[model samples]
Target: MTDNLPLAGRGCVVTGGSRGIGAAIVRLALAQGADVVFGYHSDEKRASTLVDELRAAHPDRQCSALQADVADGGEAERFATEALDRLGRLDVLVNNAGITRDALFARMRPEQWHEVIGTNLDSMYTVTRPLLMPLVKQRGGAVINITSSTGLHGVPGQTAYAAAKAGVIGFTKSLAKEIGARGVTVNAVAPGLIETDMTAAIPEDKAEFLKSLIPSHAFGSPDDVAHLVCYLASEKARYITGQVIEISGGLVL
Candidate 1:
């Protein structure tokens, strides 16, 4: 309601916002008073449900979702264009869409490698390239890429995932330098062992093993990552860019 709120009146677009960390970012963005358009790859039911809930809570805010697979360049472009159409302009772009294909390097199939790379790394170019000019023209905004702890420290069976996430980090740093002069802050958030469906799939024994690796001896929640993203998207973080801030509960330290 008040302009003093960090992201009041701003517009945001979040990819893969139908569930998990993506969903948390969407909710936090709306709570910060930003009009948001989010994309979902397949789960139309979940996407529709989230949109409905947000709309009900903020009747006057623009909260919408589109079914899109941002791994495809054409779909990414269309999703960005539609987001601009719905919100009029963009102030924050959260590249939170990614996938994991965990397998030992020796056992990994080409499709597994391709899927992870296309979704996690290539989607960065596809989703952000179309919107880059407009964001630069706007002269102030934030671009937050969701990376991972595996990217920071290599994981044994996650060769493809780690590589893709590492690429995201590299892309974020390079883009930040290019866009910083234009007032668009680009950064990456790498989460560790977050309690999402992705982590839920880990066998209980493996999950406990990971928990032991974290200094906090626990898995982080989606909100934990969302809170950091909210700060990075705000004016408070204007001076912060080209950095990878990890929310790993001391896992990487």
Candidate 2:
């Protein structure tokens, strides 16, 4: 956050930054003195407001918003180009855009499966590929993928979502090995039952029941995950890579 902090002057790109976890990441990174560009799917109003707010908060730092659906390969590529162009440099990339089409494996439609994979899994490649050269050329950068605990524990009735997120875990590990030598680091953050609009879709009773399983008897917040993200993007974590760190208040443990 300061001149001595790892994130100072680093350029950051956060997907799905209009609200929830991605928004939190944008705010935290900006507060830490990182120039930030956040991507949104549809909510241009909120995205605009966030950019305005951040500009006010960090008057001297670079802050802006971009619109792109990481689900679409072509759009993802364009988004990366625009982000790099607008930010001038990119030192950290957060793959936080995702969607869920919940249904039992037998009931899940083909469209549902494709949508989940495209938005959650395929976007990792679609988005990251465009930035790879720039990151490698710059000599170093960090890539952080956001996956759910469902990816690890295999949640029932969310076959499509689970599979795609699980793929992110493997993708992160493999990509890390390929790019670490370039001074780039890739890792995945798997959150357990985080309190977000995504979780709000679940029935309240079911959400309460899940909370009981958390040792803290509470759901994790966007800021909780943001903390770990900031840490991983810091020099303190330079030695950490190719790992899937869970922040579930001991929910997964």
Candidate 3:
């Protein structure tokens, strides 16, 4: 965070930012001059390495990584508390952390359902409840929740995952209404089908077919969503809120 950069003094938190899209967001934010804190469940070696790398680039911008299972209510609360503490005040909260336990409804175990819901849906409450106020106190702030296209339109064998993501969409819209007057904006990004470790396990032929369905004929990058996030967090997006923006290469249309 050199003297001339914008977003230099802003404080931000990115959950599950150790790898994939979350990590990409971390890098983008750091480069844009925002001091950041990222939350992780484990793999301190990887997490610490990322923090070190970002801090190296911006000595004045602080970066912290905390180990917390976003699925656990207590851990989520603690993560939010310590994140705000590290940054002093939070201007942005990106709920980019999620896990998928894909299974057909007929054979989906009860545990699969719970894990997906707890990690994906219930987590919204756990993480945001603790930090919502600090952002409002800042006079204005942004809350970005990461969702999926499968959630918007059901997919086979992903009942649990789809349900959880759909829950995020609904929750964010309602919260937007509740907080509109408080200077806090709530929005959700429903990514259609981007390449990530979660989807790396997907069969190649299937991936190709999915890509063909998309008009762009290509997968989106993490930087794609990160750009939207950066804009929404900035003064440029002051008038946009309660919207569920999709980044699916025209897959829905």
Candidate 4:
């Protein structure tokens, strides 16, 4: 059974793993046989509940959650340190934490812009910097960053989000090149209109409009994105790096 597992014996760290796609990734990674230490921003209850559920379901695996603001370097560093301590060694790092401040560029406040940028873009640096050396030293690992289609195609009311996610793409490519020779695979996963808490807040009319843009005529489930992410983290995708894989159910917008 262990040999059949894609991530058997692997150690993983995920950011923003309390709910939504990040949570999905944490769940699936553990189900696939990895020991995981995930970070949550706030909502200790939600995070603890998730950790409890995962532990119950996978009694043989290690699962824990810690609180950290990925936007702050100090907090992120502490989270990374604690996560590494819990996992012992890291084989995969998932940068799944992000926030969206949707507003037109002209009307966007400074705080909104900065918040989105700090969480979505700066987190790539804050979280990865502390854990990257372990991967390089091992000369084998995977880094999967969660970006969004808004970054690739651009959205009308998401200027700050688009900028931050786009910056994530640039960061993924450069880092992949820098560490590829060391056998670390770095890639970005771009999700489009996944069914999560964030999308649940969309207006009925707006939701329908967004759905019409997708060739599937439906929003993808969090599991859809999780499957892609897990595949990237597995040895199956060892040769694939420095790429942005979009799982948007063929959403044009």
Clashes of each: 0, 0, 0, 0
Highest TM-score scorer: 4
State candidate 2's TM-score. 0.97
User: CA RMSD for every model?
Assistant: 1.0, 1.3, 1.5, 0.6
- Alpha carbon lDDT at 10, candidate 3: 75
Candidate achieving the largest lDDT: 4
lDDT of 2 at 34: 92
Model 1 scores worst on lDDT over the 10 consecutive residues at: 1-10
TM-score of 1: 0.98
For model 1, state the Cα shift of residue 112 in Å: 0.4
By the lDDT metric, which is better: model 2 or model 3?
A: 2
Off by over 4 Å in 3: 1-6
Please rank every candidate by lDDT, starting with the best: 4, 1, 2, 3
> Candidate 2's C-alpha lDDT?
0.90
Better of 2 and 4 by TM-score: 4
Go through the candidates in order and give each one's C-alpha lDDT: 0.93, 0.90, 0.87, 0.96
User: What is candidate 1's CA lDDT for residue 155?
Assistant: 92
lDDT of 3 at 230: 78
Cα lDDT, model 4, residue 5: 99
How would you order the candidates by TM-score, starting with the best?
A: 4, 1, 2, 3
